[model samples]
Structure formats: C-alpha cells, structure tokens
Target: MTLEILTADTLAPVRHGFFTRAGGASSGVFSGLNCGTGSSDQTEIVEINRARVADAMGVDASHLIGVHQIHSADAVHVTGPVTTKPKADGLVTRTPGLALSVLTADCQPVLLADAQSGVIGAAHAGWKGAQAGIVEATVDAMVALGAIRSQIHAVIGPTISQRAYEVGPEFFEEFMDEGPENARFFAGGDGDRMHFDLPGYGLSRLRAAGIASAEWTRHCTYFDPHRFFSYRRSVHEKAPDYGRLIATIVL
Candidate 1:
C-alpha cells in the first residue's frame, strides 16, 4: 500500500503532509503508519513508519523532529536534530532541512508556516492544550524565528469533529468558565450533553492570534477508522490502545 499523505494547498511549495494510516508495517490496534513511539506498537515498526514520513518530507529520519506532547501550551524552538523529544506540545523552526512534526489520534495536528520568513511549526493541540493557548504559543515561537504573524498560515488536520465529540455538562462548563463566548463553540447534545467543536475552536484561536490564515482539513478522525486513528473510538470499542497519525512540515 502506498502511504497516503494529505497536503493542504494553502501550505503549498513547502514540504508538509498529514499522513494517514495507509501504508505501514504495524498490525493489531497499531496497524498502518503508527509513527507514535509512545504507542505500544513495535519500536522498530514505529521507526520505519516515521522514516517513511521523513522520506516523504525529503529529510532524513533524524531531521523529522517531534515533542513529548504534555498537552500544555508550551512551544519550543528547534534548530537541528533532536536527540530527545522535549516536554512540549508544539515545535517551531526557522532552520532549513528540519521537519517539525506532531502526532495525533483525535486531537488536532496543526501545521503552520511563514514561507516568506523560512519559518515553520507543528503543534499537538488536544482540548486542554488548545484551551491553554498552544496555538498562540506556537505562533509566538515562530515569530521568535523571524516569522511575521500576518504572514503565517496554519492548517488543522484530521481531528475529531463535533458530531463525534460528545461531552458532558462539566466539559461544556469548563470552556464556559474560560469565557462565556466559548459557548458558541458548543452545540446542545442529549440533555446535558454537548458537542464541542474542536477544529472550530482551533480556527478561532489561530484567527484571534492574528495569523494570516487558518483552516481545518475537515477530516473527522473519530468518524473514519480506516484512514485515521481515533483515541475516543478505541475507548468506545474497548481497545487497549490506538495508533497515532503523523503530520509534518519542513522548511
């Protein structure tokens, strides 16, 4: 099977992709392009999958870098090969030949670039990270690398959509407590349940951060098992674990 790499025209001319679970060496719950080293998938197989992504991005596996993803707003600046994944949710770089990557199952994998400034970024934004301002943090990191906020373009890729993201009243209240205006991002669900729009909220955050443009690919991970890996879907099915999708951007 050929690797399925989803690219956004908006990030064009720059090497980047939202890699799907199409062609990979893993099996069981970690089948197809499971690049997550944190997963229970075989370490060798995960490395192979990540190598495929690196090749697609025209870089060596060493240059395909990622963070530890603590679901915080922390973003780090990188200039070279990372010997260890830093304890952060976002990565930004102005150095050429280094690919900034993020791993996701249901959370948003956001790729950002200011081509004119030769700066790029990738972020893993789960609900907590987004609410904590991971996207803004990433933008700030990129700016530190000489990127203009007005020249940056961001694309959110393959996340769980609202129709599949049912949450309880407490979850809804969490966002509301952040700001009552956040209520607009939630739709009424069954009784006290609500459907939170993760991608919508991400877009709003990116736009509010004064980025040049931002958009979601609109591919719902939870709704598409064959092409994506969804943590929520795995939990609903009582699966022990789930594979992670990899999104990358290189300058």
Candidate 2:
C-alpha cells in the first residue's frame, strides 16, 4: 500500500505529514511505518521506515532528527542531525535541509512552522507532556530560532479522541488541579470514568501559547485500525507491542 500522509493547510509551504500505518515493512503487531528506534521492532526495519519518512520530507535519512521523548515539556533547538537523541519532547530548527520528526501511537504529534521565519518544529505531546506545557515550550523554542509567536502555525495530528479516551477520577482530578476550567475538556463517561478531549485540549494549548493558527487532523488513532497505530487500543487487545506513527516537518 502507498503511504497515507495526512496534512493540514494551516502548516502549508513547509513539507509536513502525519504518516499513517501504511507503506512500511514491519509485520504482526508492529506493522506499518513503525519508525520508533526505541520499539522492540527490529532496528533495521525501524530504520527503513524512518528512511521512508525522511525521503517523503525531501531530506536525507541522517538529516531527519528526533528526540528521546520523555513526555516532558522540554524542547530543544537543533541545527542538524545528531549522533545521539536529546531527552526532549519537542524539537525546533531554523536550519534548512533538516527534518524534525516525532513518534506517537495515541499521543498528539504536533507540527509547527513559521515559514516566513524559516523555523519549524515537531512535538510529542501525550497527556503528561501536554499538561506540562510541551506546546508552549515548542513555540518558545521556535521563537528563539527567529519564528514570530503570531506567525507560527501548529497542527495536532492523529491521536485518541475523547470518546475513546476514558480516564479515571485521578486523571480528571489532576487536570482539575491544574485549573477548574479544564473541566471543559472532559465529558462524563461510565460512572467515575471521564472522557478527555485530548485534541481539543491540544488546540487550547496552542492558542493559549499565541500560535497564529492551530488545528487537529481529526483522525483518531484508536478508532482507525487500518490507518493508525494506537497504544491504548493495543493494550485493550492484549497485544504485546504497538507501532509508533511518525510525523515529520522539514525546512
């Protein structure tokens, strides 16, 4: 199958994509474009997948850079590919000929660019990273690279949606502790379970960070088995491991 890449108009001019689980060499549980080097999937196969992504972004495989993604708010500025990945959830670069990428299963894969300033960034924003301010941190990193706060456009790619994101009272309380207004991002689920609108919360964070425009691709990873890889869905199915989707942006 050909690669299925989802794009947002808000981030136009820059080559960016939210790649689906298609056009890859892996099989069984980690099938389809599992670009995560950290996965149990064969390292060679993962490298192949990442090379495909790098090609799509018009860069050499070595020019495609990613972080360790510790689910923190940390963002790093990069000028080129590194021999070792940094411990960060976000990456920003103003340099040309470099691609910034992130791996996600159900987490938000956020791509941001200020084409006018020649700045681009990619972020891995699971709930922990999002709540900790990954989006804001990414925008700030871009700004430090010469991107204007009001010129940056951000897009949250495929992720688990609210209807599929059932959470415990502790999760709900944790967000509430951040702010009572966060209640707006949740809906009542079965009994004490609450459904969290992760994409909605992500957009809220982007706008709050003063991004000129932000949008979600509206593709739910948990709901689309053929096109996406979902960590939560894999757990529910009792699968041993799940593929990580790759999202990339290049300058």
RMSD of each: 0.7, 0.7
Off by over 4 Å in 2: none
The lowest-lDDT stretch of 10 consecutive residues in candidate 2 is 30-39
- Strongest candidate by lDDT: 1
Tens-digit per-residue lDDT, 1-251, candidate 2? 77889999888889989999899989899888898788899999998988888888889999989999899999999988799999999999988998898999999999999999999999999999999999999999999888999999999999999999999999999999999999999999889999999999999999998879999989999999999999999999999999999999997
1-251: candidate 1 lDDT, tens digit per residue: 99999999888788999999999989999989999999999999999999998998899999999999899999999989978789999999988899999999999999999998889999999999999999999999999989999999999999999999999989988898999999899998888889999999999999999999999999999989999999999999999999999999998
Give all candidates' CA lDDT scores: 0.94, 0.93
Q: Which residue pairs clash within candidate 1?
A: none
Provide the lDDT at 248 for model 2: 90
